[model samples]
Target chain A: MDEKDGCGQDGQSTPGVNIMASMEGRGPSCLNVDKDALAGHEKPGFKLCSYVDSFSETHAGRIPIVKSGLGKEDLFSTVYVRWGIRRHDYKVVPGLYGIGHPDRASEVLVTANFKLTFDHLRRALPHISAWILVLDTKGINVWCAAGKGTFSTRELVKRIEACSLEKIVDHKRVIVPQLGATGVSAADVKKQSGFRVVYGPIRAKDIPAFLKNNRTADKPMRQVTFTLYERFVLTPVELKNALKPAFIAALVLFVVSGVGPGGFSFSGAWERGLLAVLALVTGIFSGGFVTPVLLPYIPFREFAAKGIIAGSVFAILLMVAISSAINGMAGFGALFLFSMAISSFLAMNFTGTTPFTSPSGVEKEMKRFIPVQVVALAVSSGLWIYSAF
Target chain B: MKNLRYLDNVSTLVLDDEKCVGCSLCTEVCPHAVFEMAQNRALIVDLNACMECGACVTNCPSGAISVSPGVG
Candidate 1:
């Protein structure tokens, strides 16, 4: 299961943690490695950690992390090592990095100029000697860099010039990942730099094998796999983001209800309020996290709509139980309204992830669904107000 | 063959034949099959269908393609 598909590199957690926590059920979203603290190592030893080849901390940005002490120990091994949690952290300038002496004529691989992108690529190639010339895509992934134009021809040429690739590699050829096909020109590189660009497999792991098989990627290697593991990692970020608003709303519901004398009673309001908190959290989680994981098998592909349906069902069950158990005021009307509100929140966040969704699709969804959500919330609020009286 | 055109103002997804050296460089880099060779020349076949993913422009050997949007 290649881990590249987990919502790319967006970390969980948005902001206002305290407010969201008071409500219960906040959004999902962390970092870093101290060598002595790791499980496998103690004494002064090398740790497997990704270094961000380049990034800016001036704004909030992620540094891909790779822990220490994980590669093969054999002196002549050309194998890649795996250890700790391979985090997309560690920032540095995009270029060839030599943890040890890189034999000048070994292999020259191409990757995104982004610090995290470069970090991940190099970290995977641990224990191997190679020259990595990162294209300047201004901190973007390979697929996105191709789309955005930053990872296109000029930059590849520029990076090649900057790295002095011609001087470094004796062979007049460079191996590029297939994902960069959307931007790199093979023949043009050959003409200008006298280095024919050879596309390797879509993944870095396959690079060693691709080279072993004489610099060629099979068609299967060219295809991107959207596997289960890829989808699973993304679930956390979606859930993490939703947790904030969901919890805040629940807590406000709890604290506000307790303000009145009879409503705030420990035995009376406490249990009821707690139930509501649970319901809200469940609704949000169902919509954001659970719904997405079950996206393909969960009946619908329209992410937001699927999220809403899932959230709505969770909310209904929750509200119904609360109403029946506590003999509370939320009858059919309030239940309908509030359930829809939770559903809408989940639906809204689906856009943060999910491929195949275009800008137009998002606009259409917002147009049709946002109104319904606002109306439902308003109706729920009105019903709550009416019930209180 | 798809009739491709570059939206130069918006992105670096175009090919200037004047600078193009008749090398099949752009065609090789574009994963989406956006570029095609016509009479030993490179052309953008499906201009409207282009997602503006900067493949052709980046690998253009003659510095013919440019994805000029954000200031470098």
Candidate 2:
């Protein structure tokens, strides 16, 4: 979709303009184009459509309307969309949207423009009809966007005024996700737009219970938990992002491993290079996969430290298993250093994805571990090259 | 915040109790429950629990709170 299509900066949609026109020719009926087909579904109360009808448009802009609950189509599309996002299919047009049959009296829930976040919010509120005020967070999730200031008081006020929200909703309150509180000032929002900001539950799933309990969130609902399942689900994207750098490092190791006293030769080079590659891969598994899965069980409070320990253990096991492949003590030392460095670096990258890490903690970790990792890698590379000669 | 705690003495959160009006907005907005209402003013009950997300600082109408963003 063109960036300006759904809601113009001035809060207006060019009437009758089909925003889904671009998406129409792309695929089959999975697009859910026909309004009649959407409304005629087996799901009686819910409805889905790609384009916003004239009835839902306001002076501010048009709001895309969709079914309240998650259907088979929504789940299927979500999986594919999440995969696409890893490949950088970002830029979902930002604006207000309607979930179920929302009216002015319905609760107004605020969220970021990231499509995955939007989908999660809408899907969570299956039975309740609500107005979702999506801020232009540059397609970032609420937490990170709030930290970046994209989901700030200024953007909230601008979007509210632009959407002419006062005219549509009878209430002056807007429910904001708890994670966005860092960026949104309730007092400032009240002063600027006369709308009171109510902080909601930390997780979308808790919204139903929260709303049912008269918008009062319990301690559990307010808290953010990073369970094993949550950590596991995030590993795929982390692994995908790390692939290019890992490949480059492996390639460098392969070439460097080929150098020997007699100069580069295919026979000895392949054996050494293959061993180096195996060690590197083992490090990646320990750092990227094992550390995250065993985060709570890991002995160290620092992620890098945990990674180093895990990598060292793996390196020791590998060395013991393939002692015959080693040329000298230098080979074992190089392998140990190489694995530890790789694991430490990869585990540090996970700090951003984890809930336990704070920005201050991350900064401290980077300062303490980055130099150590650099020295370790440098020493390991030197040893590998020296051993070859 | 309830069952989990990261490194201690790392959060860059600062609260000026003299300027605080005890609105409890910080307590309400903080996902980690870093603040508590004591007497008429908000107190930093669990300073180490803070993730330094700046939610309390932003919501404080009296400019009583300050946290260096991106410092964790």
Estimate how well candidate 1 is docked, as a DockQ score: 0.15
lDDT of 2 at A259: 88
Cα displacement (Å) at residue A314, model 1: 2.3
B24-48 per-residue lDDT for model 2 (tens digits) = 8888888777888989899998878
What is candidate 1's CAPRI-style docking category based on DockQ?
A: incorrect
Least accurate 10 contiguous residues by lDDT in model 1 chain A: A75-84
Top candidate by lDDT: 2
What C-alpha lDDT does candidate 2 achieve relative to the native structure?
0.78
**Model 2 CA lDDT for position B43:** 90
Error of 2 at A293 (Å): 1.7
TM-score of 2: 0.85
List where candidate 2 sits over 4 angstroms from the true fold.
A1-33, A37-62, A71-77, A80-87, B1-3, B69-72
Give the Cα error of residue A156 in candidate 1, in Å.
Answer: 3.2
